[model samples]
Target: MIWNEHIECMDREQIEKLQSQRLCEMVERVYYNVPFYRKKMQVLGLEIGDIKGIEDLHKLPFTTKDDLRENYPFGMFAVPMSQVVRVHASSGTTGLPTVVGYTRNDLSNWSEIVARALYGAGVSKEDRIQNSYGYGLFTGGLGLHGGAEKVGATILPLSGGNTRKQIQSLVDFEPTAISCTPSYLLYLAETLKEEELLDKIKLRVAILGAEPWTENMRKEIEKQLNIKAIDIYGLSEIMGPGVSFECINQCGSHIAEDHFIPEIIDPKTLKPLPRGSEGELVFTTITKEALPLFRYRTKDLSSLIYETCECGRTSVRMTKITGRTDDMLIIRGVNVFPSQIESALLEIGETQPHYMIYVDRVNNLDTLEVWVEVDEKFFSDEIKQLEALTRKITKQIVNIIGISVKVKLVEPKTILRSEGKAKRVVDRRHI
Candidate 1:
């Protein structure tokens, strides 16, 4: 799988024809191998031949998280359990995790896609990659590790946590690149600063993903660590972290068009949205054997572009996810994302980076509050000054989120620091 030479550099017409051919085969394979899909097809009165190509893809029923949950462990799997070499699961905060399986060929295919992403980002066989993404049920660690190895990269498989150990590995290994969540990398940068080992380690690129991050955050990390921070995007349901990645251009992440077909649709109506339109990302796995999902609604909000990228790849480009449709919060009829609050908080230079959002219902009305940690160096004993600082943050939040929020300024380290997905929202009303 030398990166599928013809597919990578194909013209628009050629790519479309290849995708159409692959889609028809995948749909037929799913109908025969997976009972869940067969039942869905039966109810819809659809047959294998009906879906002759990509155009018929829109006719197929969309798969969702509920479908995966309904099937539980193996009902949706296209291959037998004995053939499955690995299984990865979702975080499962809501209920039972959505599980995904992979055969040996599937794993190899995944590695190839991931390698393409790495190669596009300038990672070559000679480089050493330090992987800080967690290993296990989560796909980040192993997904990236396998790809780095496929590219002949010497990998330092240092999973997340243990800040001291992570920094030690960085110094000892002196890897040329690193992969992990953006927030965790920021935390690592802070730790490295405290240890005064920033200059000793050598890293040119940092592949960050798994959560939504902004260009502002990217600039901050780049400045702190002195590395070119590149954005890599993927979901566990799709194929881990190599579904798409930003090439050298840094404009947007290029989706692996040949393997996973990308489509944008309105989350509410499920109607197809036009290209370059921001909507929920839906994917149809074209060549996947173990689990070929047809039109799986990812709920991730992004836009799609199908033009030649500056990086010279014909693969489609997807904008960085601003926020997930499911994660949106309704506060007094105003829709908001935690990232909006974070962006507002960052603008206020007075407060520290540590902050938490709280929502409560009082007399059937929602109330918003933010707890912002104050740096010890900027701490003042006067209550009036602290109140003034809080007022400034409150105004900033109001301007950004269009909702007035009470800001509480506390001492340093008052709020906990999370290395994984940051717990920014506390909805007492939901409880």
Candidate 2:
């Protein structure tokens, strides 16, 4: 299922050589076309000719989201509006949205990379895919849609929400694959079970991304939906959902190094870490035509692996993202990630996957409370049983995260379900 085997499985030497050439060209393109990048390079005492290859990538100045916002619309674009054919942007909760543009060639290349991602996740023309990601401004829908088209798969463009229609399409269309956020997939599973349509559909593969999910969550999704759950990694700031993807082996997600060069660096020191060392992930777009970025800091924490995968793709792979540095919750001076809590809850195997973390300040001290859902059958048990379960959960979380948390057990379907990325935390301390 490896698309573009020649590039995906290229030798390390060939890959680096091709990357070096593209990197040099990208540097030159941005230097003359984008003033922001040119100024950043000049400030760092760099010229277009100075960047000869990917080896000198570390010397280039890193681009941040603030830089994009400071420039506002189209300032980061390397090509003029006449040559740009499409534009995609991140969902900016505050201030202006980060803007990105694409040339005709850029969109075409985007399709191919997304196709490679879908192929890596075992999608093909024979499969009917139900894409549940949203359309319009959101990159997830169009990104997955283009890739599905490139793979020649039958597409049911049922963008996110409307659980009833999604289930109806699943039963009626009988799609063999699906794409959506992992949490939304779980929500869909719940609805399908309620409607008794889980067995009517024929889904064998799920291309899930948009947020960090743990292995336990993957297993829960697979077990509930009766499908192979594969993780796809990407960002609108970089490329949508096709940056990298896991092969059937599921060892790690193989990065498309021939296009996007990835580097893991210590977030504190801003120094590149050796492979397998966890740090902030950074990417440089060497093939993008409309908007070329130099060492864009993704702020995601993950390590890389260069060992050729069992899938036979020589493209270097990244481990599952632990969490975003911005998303880390510091409670009582101890750092914790929502994914870690989800993993612990799933490993305990005593409650449903639906849960939420509440962080607040009590008497000037940070407090953490975890609300978990239990099956109705168990929830209706004697008071002592629920109390024991609560104690067990509190103990388990403290043991794993090194922070004492008040555990609240609730009935099934109490917490709101999300058809997109699940909102896992309610931090009122800032408010």
Candidate 3:
């Protein structure tokens, strides 16, 4: 079931050797071609020769989102604009967008890694894939499209939005696989149920990412849609949606270590953490030609597993992302993440996966309020019963997140649906 066994299932020592060689070459390329990287290395009194192998990766300065912003547009690109064949940019909600470039070889490699990801999800050429990720400046759509084509699978290039058309194509095309954000998939499932077309479609595997989702939510997706849900992790700064993926076994997502070296580091101290310790996930793209990044901090929180998987891939695996360090919210001296609230709500089983967290300062005290969408069945319940359910959810949140939260049980579909990454938090204190 493995694809590109030479790289995915290579011996651990051999894999490290390959990574070491690639790392050395990448460091040299950035040192000479990228002034930003060269200045950072020179400031540390380090040279290309100093980075001999993967062992010396720690010596290299970490690349942050702010660093990418400072460079802006094509400034971070290692190759000339003529050599770059493709460009993708982040939404840049905070400020200037981080732009990434890809050479011809980089695109091919991106396709290959995405192909490997599809294969790990039990996809085959016989299966038709519906790519629902956004297209254009976003990487998810084209990333999955190229990967599906690389795998020799038929592709339906139906990007995000157009819910009616998305469902129509699903039933008409009867695609066997789908790739999109998990929340969007849930919305699609709701649409299918509403239109009474769930049985008409033939979707088997869902490759979901672009947002951090909980396992409880996955089970709900599986139950509602009657399909196997697999998590795929990627960011636009890297190669896109094919960075890593979950196999059918679903133990952990196997990293494409040959192209991107994975590292877990303590976000606060910036020191490498031991394997299996939950910390910030970092990546260094050694195989990229147009834009080779050194120790790019992803801000995602996850642990790494180096043991061989039952699926027989020797590539290291990463646990499901818990949350982003930057996304963590401190309310009333308690650290909270939206994912924790999601996990708590989904664990309760009576509410839908759709929920929102609102944080504000009330009377100079930080307060947290959670708005949860309840199933239609719950809406018909007695008024007292609904109040009891709200109390129950409040207790669960307090127990799980160690903070008191006011729970509001709203009607289903009341929460705004997103075609891309879901907006789960609304911090009003800043306003």
Candidate 4:
């Protein structure tokens, strides 16, 4: 089932050797071709020869989103415009989107990794992949598209939205697999349920990412969709939706270590941490041509597994991302991630999966409220019964995050659903 056994099943020592060689070449590429990185190396008194291998990776400068934005549209591109083949960017909700470029070689490499991801997750030439990820500026749609094409599977380029059309295509094509955000798939599953068409279509595997999801959520998704849900990891900065993926074993996502060296680091100190330690994830692209990055801090929180997988891959795997440091909310001196709240809610199993967190400062103090949707059967219960369920949810969340949150129980299907990344948090506090 391995798409490229040569790289995926390589020995750990051999993988490290290859990474070192690629890292050195990548440093030289960035040092001379991009002045932004050259200035960073010079500031650290680093020369091209100083970086001999991946062992010297810690000695180099780290790249951040600000650095990418500071470079603006094309400042970070290592290759000239004539050589650049394509561009993809972030949503830029806060500022200018971090623009990523690709040469012909880079695009080919991107598609190769994505194809490996799809094939690793049980996709094959015999399968039909209905790509639900949006196409254009974003990387998810096209990233999976190329991967599906490389798999030689029939492609249904049904971009994000249009639930009716997605379900219709599902029924007509009987695609064996799908690719999209996990939250969107959940919404799609609900739609299928409403139409009583769950069993009519044939969907065996799901490739999901672009947002942090808990193990409980994954189980719920699999249960609801009647398909094996696999977690796929990638970011626009790190080559999009195929940076790594879970195999049939589903222990963790196997990283493409040969192309991008992965590291777990203490987010606070910006220092590398030991394997199995939960910390911020960082990556260094060694084979990228258009936009090569050195030690780019991803700000995602996860642990690394270095052992060989049952699927026979020696490449290191990263546990599912717990949360993003950037998405963390600090309330009354306590930091809380929405994923933690989500995990707590799902474990309770009393409320529906749909919920929202509202944070606001009132009367010189910060207030947190959780709007939980009561299960359909419980929504019409007596006030006392509803109050009891509310208390139960409140206690579970308080116990997990050490914060007192007012739990408000609402009716099922009351919360708005999204076909893209779910909007789980609404922070009204102005800081």
Best by lDDT: 3
Displacement of the residue 270 alpha carbon in candidate 3, Å: 0.5
Clashing pairs in 4: none
* Estimated TM-score for each candidate: 0.77, 0.78, 0.78, 0.78
Candidate 2 residue-pair clash tally: 0
Candidate 2 residues 1-431, lDDT tens each? 78999999899999999999999988888889898888888888898888888889999999887788887788888887999888887633232557888888888888999899889888999899999988866688999999899989999999977888998999999999999877678878888888888889899999988766779878988999889999998888787788999998899999989889999999988999987899999999999988888899988888999999998999999999876766666454234678778877877787887999999766434579999988764574588888998888888877777657999987678998988989899987552
Query: Tens digits of per-residue lDDT for model 3 on 1-431?
Result: 88898899999999999999999999988888999999998899998888889999999999987788888888889999999999998643233457899999999999999999999998989999999887887788899999999999999999977888899899999999999877678778988888898899999999988766678869978998899999988887889988999999998999999999999999999999987899999999999999899999988889999999999999999999876778766454234667778877778888888999998766434679999988986675588888899999999878777657899877789999988989999987542
Residue-level lDDT of model 4, residues 1-431, one tens digit each, is 99999999999889999999999888888888999989888988999999898889999899887788788889989988999989998733233557999989888988899889988998999999999988887788999998888889899999987888999999999999999877678778878888999999899999987766667768978898788999888988879888999998899999998889999999999999987899999999999999999889988888999999999988999998876767666564344667778877888886667899998766424689999887875565488877888888888888777668999877678898988989888987543
Reference-based lDDT, each prediction: 0.82, 0.84, 0.86, 0.85
The TM-score that candidate 3 achieves is 0.78
lDDT of 3 at 421: 85
Q: Among all windows of ten consecutive residues in candidate 3, which has the lowest summed lDDT?
A: 89-98
The residue ranges of model 1 lying beyond 4 angstroms of the native Cα positions read 1-5, 328-431
Judge candidate 3 at residue 212 and give its lDDT.
65
